[model samples]
Target: MSVRRPAAEVLQPKSFSFNEKNLLVVDTILSKYPKEKKASALLPLLDLAQRQNANWISTAAMKVISEILSLPLIKVLEVATFYTMFNLKPVGKNLLQVCTTTPCWLRGSDDIVSACKKKLGIDFGETTQDNKFTLLEVECLGACSNAPMVQINDYFYEDLNEDSMIKIIEDIQKGSKPKPGPQSKRTGSEPHNNRVKV
Candidate 1:
């Protein structure tokens, strides 16, 4: 689904150019596509821009991408605006994408959401004052079997309860990286209690 992302003009940077390392990455990505089809590199280019610009794609960045891909500025803006993954505005260092879909809800995702809100003192779509975390309620993240999960950055911490969720936040606050995956005894998506039937 498309998200409501305002331009938030005040936050926009005056200009954006990929650093030397990322410029090399951009070339590598562009080389995969035919010269005539350089437009195909739009997504990765936008991703690289977002990574370079602190996890959000700015209008300036999109313009640079359009120039690089030989695509129109509007074409790049269309893709960036249409995709929910592209954040138009600034986000925190740790984007906490909590899943509240049916599977996770049935597995007590509400409590997980509550834990995040309480622990961070910020509701969904809000960021902490320290810019450490941004709480967002997202759709399923494909870990239904180990539901009640929250994706912190690129890692998924699943099978969470209120207390466990609180602990995770506390660990992050203390500069410790909480281990990802099932928070319970189960390993991966295996059956609970290790009760494997023949």
Candidate 2:
């Protein structure tokens, strides 16, 4: 499948540079690889660039990465475009990645998706007007045991139903950080109804 990148004239930034802190991080990452094998640092550098550039990888940022690693620009672009984790366009502060794999689906992930869309007033692959949330349907986030989950940025909110999902979004909008993990009474992937003794 072809990946769609934003038009350069439309959304690309003029340039990108790592800040002092990230530059130090770059040096540390590069140090882990042999000087001749600097390209191995490409993924981490791209990740750093994305984090520094508001969670999206711009063309200019990719170019900067290529120059830093002494790699061809195409190599950087190929890696960036191939990874779903790399966003080509700007995203909101909270990236809501709903897992809709078979496990999640079986556990009512559809309701979670609907709740997010209605609460955020945006469909999948779209961001809210306030730029606080972007909703996307992703494959399994490896939390099948906690099926029907949504990953908000770096945190996972599992064991969700429609009401809990809506409340989580509302909490974020109100500038409150909802505790991450199972929304239900169960704890940390433990069996429901205390089926297993810990």
Candidate 3:
């Protein structure tokens, strides 16, 4: 079956450029790849641009990345579109990616999702009106041992119950970064709850 795409995503913005600050970063990422394979840095550059662009990879990001890698626009767009990790649309400041894979689901990920929906008043794939948070149900985040986890931006909040999950969102809205990993003090490396792996 042919996969349908969103009416070509009115994403190609007028133009794009990396600011002076990101120029340094872009150069550094590009430097890690041989000149002949500079395009390999596309993923990292796109990620940096997403962080710089409020978690979405816009037309500007695609264009800028294309220019930097001396690649075709379609090539850059293809990569960006293929990866779910790159949000094509605008997202709130804190992107809450809740893992709903088997492990997390078996461990009450549904309840965590419900709590987020009730607390944030937006369903998965929607952002709160205030733009502080966007909710999403994603695949495994590679932290299954700590199942029922939610990643706010770059940090993982794992071993979550509804209460702890909601509390983490509250802390984020209050401009505080909750400590990452298990909420119950059972870090992921541990063999049991209530203990950190030494």
Candidate 4:
């Protein structure tokens, strides 16, 4: 069965344009394609623009990208709205994505979600007042054997329990880089107490 993402409420910022550094990145992304095929760079350009403008893609930014690539405004908007990776609304500095698919659920992902709701005082799709963290429950993050895991920003932290999850959240709240991934003594997803291949 095909699944659809619940549409995000898109907000239009009054204006948006990349900074000098990002403009250079934008130029490079565009340069990869022939002038006639520059529109082919739409996905990367939108991604770069979203990162440049903060974590969300504004309508204005989409328009600018459309103009640069000479694609219709609708073309850019269609791509941006269709992909969940392109945040339509603003997200907190730290986006916490918990994996709650079958493997994770069986392995106690509910405990992870409970821990987040308890500590953050917010449910999924909500951000903190301080804009520090946004909590979201996502399907498989591809860490099945590491079963219960979460992705914060770009890092995957695995082998989580309630306390460890809370500690990670608290650490981020205090602006420190908590060590990421496999909080247990185990390395990666290797089974416990194993010194060598089975």
Total clashes, candidate 3? 0
* lDDT of the candidates, in the order given: 0.89, 0.89, 0.84, 0.85
Worst 10 residues of 1 by lDDT: 1-10
lDDT string for model 4 (127-166, tens) is: 7777778888898989888879999988999999999999
Q: What TM-score, computed on C-alpha atoms, does each candidate reach? A: 0.93, 0.93, 0.89, 0.89
Winner of 1 and 2 under TM-score: 1
Regions of model 1 farther than 4 Å from truth: 1-10
Candidate 3 residue lDDT tens string, 1-198? 111124354354576677899999998998899999999998999999888877788887788789889999899889998998898887788889999999999999999999998988887777777888878889998998888898888888888999999888889889988899889767564766455657
Q: Residue 142, candidate 2: how far off, in angstroms?
A: 0.8
Best by TM-score: 1
Candidate 3's C-alpha runs over 4 A off are 1-13, 193-198
Better of 2 and 3 by lDDT: 2
Better of 2 and 4 by lDDT: 2
Candidate 1 lDDT score at position 23: 94
State candidate 1's TM-score: 0.93
lDDT of 1 by residue, 1-198 (tens): 112234553468878899999999999999999999999999999999998888888888998998898889999989998987888888888989999999999999999998898888888887788888888899988999999899988899999999999999999999999999999998798888687778
Write out the backbone clash pairs for model 2. Answer: none
lDDT head-to-head 1 vs 3, winner: 1
